[model samples]
Target: MGFNMALLALRNDFKKWSFILWIVIIALSVYVFANWGAQGKIGQPTSVIASVDGDEILFKEYVE
Candidate 1:
């Protein structure tokens, strides 16, 4: 009996706040997906990670 009452109260509280919950969820989803889409347009990093004096340092060579 007590457990059922607690569950009912929790359900009512969720119903009251459902709209705010949806807004928060949608806002976070939009922010995450927007950033994900932007990453593709930014392009990948160059093969040459750096340059020193007159020499260009390739990423692979730099790692070794």
Candidate 2:
């Protein structure tokens, strides 16, 4: 039925595109595998490590 037709069409497409599709899939897999640890290397606590002002430097005191 429809499944058989789809199978036939899929086979045709595979014949036409198997090589290009394989290249694309291999490239994507390599890129993904290489960048697998990139996520863990991001979002680190990049903080301001120094301060010169006093602890009681409030906005109300500065406004007066």
Candidate 3:
């Protein structure tokens, strides 16, 4: 469907839309968080330290 029609449909069906919007936002958040370390690049991480292979690791995306 076209963009305007899709949004218009949602407006006419608000009850269904509330549920659908929630689900879509949740799904999108999951996808984003899952890809965060790979693609997300922003925000502030104060310490920025973690462990790997029993070794203390820093920076991001391994030492690679």
Candidate 4:
């Protein structure tokens, strides 16, 4: 009977640790995906539409 009780306690501990490990893994996966997704292109310009003196106007700026 004592051995059965000990086994139950060990199983509960294993479940708690497994749940925490899964949560960490999922959070890291989401972070890595989002970080990579945000970097659209390596060297693509936002595009400069015009320039005055030395300042330039970007396409994004014109749209906004």
Clash numbers, per candidate: 0, 0, 0, 0
Q: What does candidate 2's lDDT look like per residue over 1-64, in tens digits? A: 9999999999998987988898999999778755754654333333344444754432321110
Cα lDDT computed for each candidate against the true fold: 0.74, 0.64, 0.73, 0.75
Arranged by TM-score, best first: 4, 1, 3, 2
Poorest lDDT segment (10 consecutive residues) of candidate 1: 40-49
What's the CA error at residue 21 for candidate 1, in Å? 0.7
TM-score of model 2 vs. true structure: 0.35
Winning candidate number (TM-score): 4
Could you tell which candidate, 3 or 4, scores higher by lDDT?
A: 4
* Candidate 3 lowest-lDDT run of ten: 37-46
- Residue 32 in model 3: lDDT: 77
Better of 1 and 4 by TM-score: 4
List model 4 lDDT by residue over 4-57, tens digit each: 999999999999999999999999988876675576433344665788898886
- Error of model 4, residue 5, in angstroms: 0.8
Candidate 3: RMSD over Cα atoms? Answer: 11.7
Report the poorest 10 consecutive residues by lDDT, candidate 4: 55-64
Better of 3 and 4 by TM-score: 4
